[model samples]
Target: MHTEIQSMHLRASQKQLTLHTGVYYTGMDDEAHTFCTVSDSLQHSPSAIWAYLTPVLDRIKAEVSDVDTINFYSDGPATQYRQKGNFYLFNKEMADRNMKQATWNFHETSHGIGVPDGVGGSLKRTENMSVLHGKDITTATDFVKTVKTPDSKIRIFQVTEEDVKSKIIEKLKLQPIPGTMKIHQILSVKRGELWYRDLSYNSMEVHEHQGQHLKFFSFWKVIMLYSICSLH
Candidate 1:
């Protein structure tokens, strides 16, 4: 399971608006859902992305109550899904939801094609066709009404500026791990443990999350041990 966000443009008359769209899917499931938020600006920062994801994740949790572990596959975008802010927020949500484990796997640069990509394309295509047929989509609400059909599986949400501001998690602060790129192949963060691996999925480093931050010394020790083993 993973998430992807894309910015789409809509027009009515001479006015143009930006729609921040998110698609969540797991390959095992036959159905995928789409969430859209209308914004006047095109900013897609970590907080903004998380704000859009909050409701979508809630809906997912409700639908998949039996699933203990939720894994996310996202592109390697440091500012969006891979940063510390997003990680901290996600960790807290995982605990609140009672999820046993949560893993985030970032795809290699320029190689992140998957189910979400198809969903995003389909959404834009549908919207484009509707606009061509003279559908009025000047606002986010209008866009939601225009695209939502009785039989449609895509669940749409219109997030406002206030919604984004209210969802910020100010208490959690994440520190970076030394000698590691922000974009890693696999990042598994359980209740108190964090593990990361390279794109090859070999050679992993684990750390303990202490209170609001991760214990950086634990990671440093792992690196030193690995270095010593290589020398031997």
Candidate 2:
């Protein structure tokens, strides 16, 4: 089930509060769908907000200092967080493509580094993240989609600990890493999640993102973390 959308809110009555706004899809169906946003005197998470704004804020903070709290407004209804000392906002796009791209403002700006170059009727573009294959793995939105569509598989599996030493290995045609038997125990599959969970309930590192609650591993990073985790 989808999370309920809540009303837009503004942080109230604060002096020297900073504001940062970010856009996120959260897999919500349409542009007209409510947008979720967040801000902090510090930073907080399910981290969906960091999808765009964190990097921008890092840059903005370098320049803007007087701001201590932020103000937030959304084009429509949303379930978001706004505290007395911070501000955030979300804009609803009238179109889909822009709405989609709006969500990746960070990944695009930082990693994509794309812009028009003045020339003789010409333009130029450049991108880094050379370690990446064809796309990004840092953004949860992008990384979560990777395992869903493997080169040889379509269905995403919620592999259990038992499947770690056998099922995933056999299916992927990989020999088990010598001591990685308990690897799966450290990783809760990504099925229907804000993100995956490690064996520890504290598996994911979202800090007090919710008042009472709340939740990637990479393939190589995945293998390494699990390998070390298994030694315990």
Number of backbone-clashing residue pairs for each candidate, in the order shown: 1, 12
Q: Which structure among the candidates has the greatest TM-score?
A: 1
lDDT of 1 by residue, 1-232 (tens): 0121222232234455555555666538865566665654345776677667777777787777676677776776777776666665666667677776676677777985666666667777987788677675666667677777898777776677777776565443346544345445433445434555444333234423322122221233444565677789
Residue 169, candidate 1: C-alpha displacement in angstroms: 4.7
RMSD of each: 10.8, 23.9
> Can you list the residue pairs that collide in candidate 1?
2-73
Candidate 2's C-alpha runs over 4 A off are 1-46, 79-232
Q: How many Å off is the CA of 89 in candidate 2?
A: 13
